[model samples]
Target: MSDERDPSPYDALLLLSFGGPEGPDDVVPFLANVTRGRGIPEERLKEVGQHYFLFGGVSPINEQNRALLAALRADFAEHGLDLPVFWGNRNWAPYLTDTLRDMTLAGHRRIAVLTTSAYASYSGCRQYRENLADALAALAAEGLEPPRVDKLRHYFNDPGFVGPMADGVLTALEELDPRVRDGAHLAFTTHSIPTAAADTSGPVAGHGDGGAYVRQHLDVARLIVDAVREETGIEHPWRLVYQSRSGAPHIPWLEPDICDHLEELHDQGAPAAVMVPIGFVSDHMEVLYDLDTEATAKAAELGLPVRRSATVGADPRFATAVRELLLERAATERGSAVERCALGALGASYDLCPVGCCPARTPRPAAAGADTPL
Candidate 1:
């Protein structure tokens, strides 16, 4: 007899996330960390981050990460998986370098990094790997032998992740009037990156018509749509839309924007709509300001009824999914076969990002991948 839940070869689980400011005073400097080397002026960054000012300059991501950390720890402990969890951010306090240093001091030699972003894109995947390399390099400068890191594969189509989103959509539909609940169209939304980035997302050959980014989102939308139909017996209409775009006017990004899609639904006489943020794992500022604040306002202006679905924030199922990913990866590392869970046609993502999986515009060293320099 053998235990299937053993998470061996990985001494620690690191929750890597895109950090945010916790107060009005920390907003601009945090943005500076995020936008460094982009040459974006401080004034423009301030203008862009005005939404943070709306909530006392706090971005909900840090708190969300805290809750998610607790959930993951609780789930792991409840299941007898004795793994220590640590958290670090790319652009704020408890920054990656500091967290890695702490872990190194604590003698964690093998780390499994689980990024908050659940998709395959430059900003989502490779950038975090690059940051890991940078952090390790900093540790090297201080003569500290950094731990070996391996990023868990993408979980965009994992059942645990999609199931929560599907249920959230169902819940949102129930909030609408009975007359419109059956007819409320679904709008699956995600962040909008530049067209070039989207075109080159994930492995080069895997990019479909709109690229891996769009194709993955479409798969999730279909799965959720089918789930909703099975539960309610109504095959409601749906579309994959983009939101929170931050690019120059001349450059192209994913579309139609969620706000635009809402207006389209209203124009088409759709009774109501549910905005499902499948791309984001937590209700960070992007979902809060972009959907709840900006897009919802647009719907109001159009006299359209709309509801925003909950994200998989601190959801126990998501925590379980993370645990499965860890054990599965550990088995893979030990050269043992394991059952990987995923939804839709995409199957499971690669355990390790290959060379050129999600290349940056400028070449940079990335860790925890086939092309990792460390």
Candidate 2:
């Protein structure tokens, strides 16, 4: 092991996320930031963003991240990790560039970033790295020295993550009418990307077929299903499904969306189903509008009872998992062999993203990887 133990090379942890508007007025601008290069017109964007108004034009992600920040700070202090944690978003208030400037001004030279996203894809991984690089470039233009930044690896298969989700499945099953509980199917849901993006996610074509994105989700779904069987003595039938697809319908994204799958289950005489969002870290807009609002509405229409399982949002065990990841990465950075904690078939992901790990359609400077332009 290294001569040092905790928080040695790292001076701070940055909780980076995709931000959402806090109110009606912020919605259009937030969407504009998200679709910056698409050249979408304001009126057209407003028409597309009409669904956000249904929830008072607010998103729960910013608030959820606030709670998670508190949990991380509390956990780190309790464990005596002594690492200062900061929060920032890519598209809204507390923006990434501003946060990095603040950190550098505060004399923090080294920072480790953790994102709300837990998987590998262009949008999930490489895009965030590109955002980091852009923010650092902005800081440099502002005459501030850029802090060295590294992003944490994918944690989809971490026990702390999968365990809570497994419990969520069990709890949702218990909430069902008990008559339908035993027969209820488990549908693991994740965000749908274009087929090309899925094919290129993670390392080395992510090992064929649906690539690392689908492969990783499958591994997690199987692990959760196995855990449920071990506890309840019933092997719940399950399948990995996709959700929250955007972009042109002609592009062909991941199929059998959660709503459509619900319809299929109903027609097939399936008693009930649980929507497990293993793809997301928190119950963000996608979980709320897509699953809770839209999919639930679809299920109600089909008379099929369904409950959405919980995301890992602000779970204490998840906070502990973040702590463990920090220590593990710290040791690895020190050239010390450390036990990397993960569950299921994929094992641990790389600490630093490899070259061409998850390439964006149009190339851009992305920090925190072998091919980082930083």
Candidate 3:
């Protein structure tokens, strides 16, 4: 049992996310932030920035994070948790370094970070930790005392996350013609990272070669499929596909792309299709542009009936789940027994990352884990 008299392990919660442009003029600079080290030219980035221009130069991510932050505050208050949540981003405004400085100045320490990304991979997990380390180092160099940032474990298989996604799939199915609904195929989509990164995502000892990235997605996809089956009594076929791939032309990324898979399904005479973005927590620019714009257009061209499902953004259940995770981790830090809440077969992820869990390409400072070579 936890001692009620003891102080909490965490002073505050930090909502960390990948930021985006909020208006037309900020679009190019936001792109520059995202591709700062990739050696991508400004001209080429401007060309890619057209996607944001098409949507009035706004990315739904920041606003979605705002809604999520509000939901978290409300949930915490309802549950009698006094932890205040602060918002920051890896790129763009309210940047991570600035947020850390503000939090320290506001007297916050031992902060728990919850990134918008929910899966395990270099980009999804390790990169965020590295960013945190960078922020702390920068603060220390400036004689600022930064808080210790511990990230919440991946929640891809949490009931709160899976529940909303399953319901979303059902709702998307309702949009299709009744005559073709029975024959609909589920296409689970996620951001496609390089094959090299995917091959080394999770703990080297237990997760095998493909690591946690592919395995976690497959587990969630199966969970969603089973949930849809249990709810609607339809055992629809499903495939875990990749999307929003961006890198050098020669690098082999995950495949087949969602658009390519849609075309294949069209040729095969599939009656209808539903896209469930199980990988992302919110409908960011990747979801809006890649799936909504590019993939939807391809499906239209192929005469394939398709509907895109919604991400779990600002859902009260998800907000409650976040609170549960925070308390659960706090309990563990206090040496108390806690039953982790998760759906499907993978079980709950580790509260703290293990050594050599998800190594970056080169050596870098990362928080909440041991970066020893496996």
Candidate 4:
């Protein structure tokens, strides 16, 4: 079905995301919330939080998300859809509970949520659901009606999403030195998690189980690669890689970090390469540190030319894709099949998540308080 066939059944759309600190004073506490269960020392967290401090303790993610919210609102208005857009973060001001409370008070029910993460994993999928549950419980205590929120399916495969990425890759290719551009290898990078966690992601299906996190990323990478080839008529070599692995050394995470991959490309006599952060929505901390800072430095040391493609931050096409996904989800009746593209040759259809499909990992602390899933 097309997006124009039906407008959203949802009363409002929530821009859900991982919030970042806006100032030096907010950095340590925000980092603390993110690493709450990890048992990382406060001093160490403070040191690590220096990445945010480098940029005046501010993260570009929140601002980027705000711009996205505006774009979404504009798109909805332009298309004559009445869905109101709201913003909430897992941590920080405009907390999920508060935002949901505002929406509830405003008489919005049956909301639709769009999480910032594009892939499936404990952090990306289940954890957010758990947060939603926590929010509902909090609203119950406050004697306020909690709105039912249905999250839109992941949009990693939408033409609106992949098309912008194709443009980015082509732009990067154009920026490279002519010699390097002709022989450039493409390296697509994303967040790394414990291999075991990656293996158990998504819902169980007829194939025995759902696609794992790594598999999902590979699927998106393949689509983007193919799209790039089709668009530019250049079959540049590419590989899906992992970055931002914070797990202990004993635990295995995804392999061959971007820096390592750049070295290998250099050794292989590749003059240049384009690093596409297909796994992220914007140049978040991982993209900033791993690709722009660290990977670029490594490439410079190796004497290999490298350019990084931009993420779909505030891109009009991406905003339109989000709108289309919302309309798609809302138009389909509950328990009915909805067709959606995945990363592979075989497309799949999914119903809305069952009640307990994606369960939350850690039990939310009582002191953290309950919140509505905005």
Q: For each candidate, what TM-score against the reference?
A: 0.98, 0.98, 0.96, 0.90
Global local distance difference test of model 3 = 0.89
Writing each residue's lDDT as its tens digit, candidate 3 over 23-49 gives: 999998898888878888888988999
What stretches of model 3 exceed 4 Å from their correct place?
A: 1-7, 206-209, 371-374
lDDT of each: 0.91, 0.91, 0.89, 0.78
Count backbone clashes in candidate 3: 0
Better of 3 and 4 by TM-score: 3
2 or 4, which is superior by TM-score?
A: 2
Candidate 4 has its poorest 10 consecutive residues by lDDT at 365-374
Q: Which window of ten consecutive residues has the lowest lDDT sum in model 3?
A: 1-10
lDDT score, candidate 4: 0.78
Inter-residue clash pairs, candidate 1? none
Say which prediction, candidate 1 or candidate 3, comes out ahead on lDDT.
Answer: 1
* Residue 313's lDDT in candidate 3: 98
Query: Each prediction's Cα RMSD?
Result: 1.2, 1.5, 2.2, 3.9
Best by lDDT: 1
Off by over 4 Å in 4: 1-8, 205-211, 334-351, 354-374
lDDT of 2 by residue, 68-124 (tens): 999999999887788899999999999999999999999999899999899988899
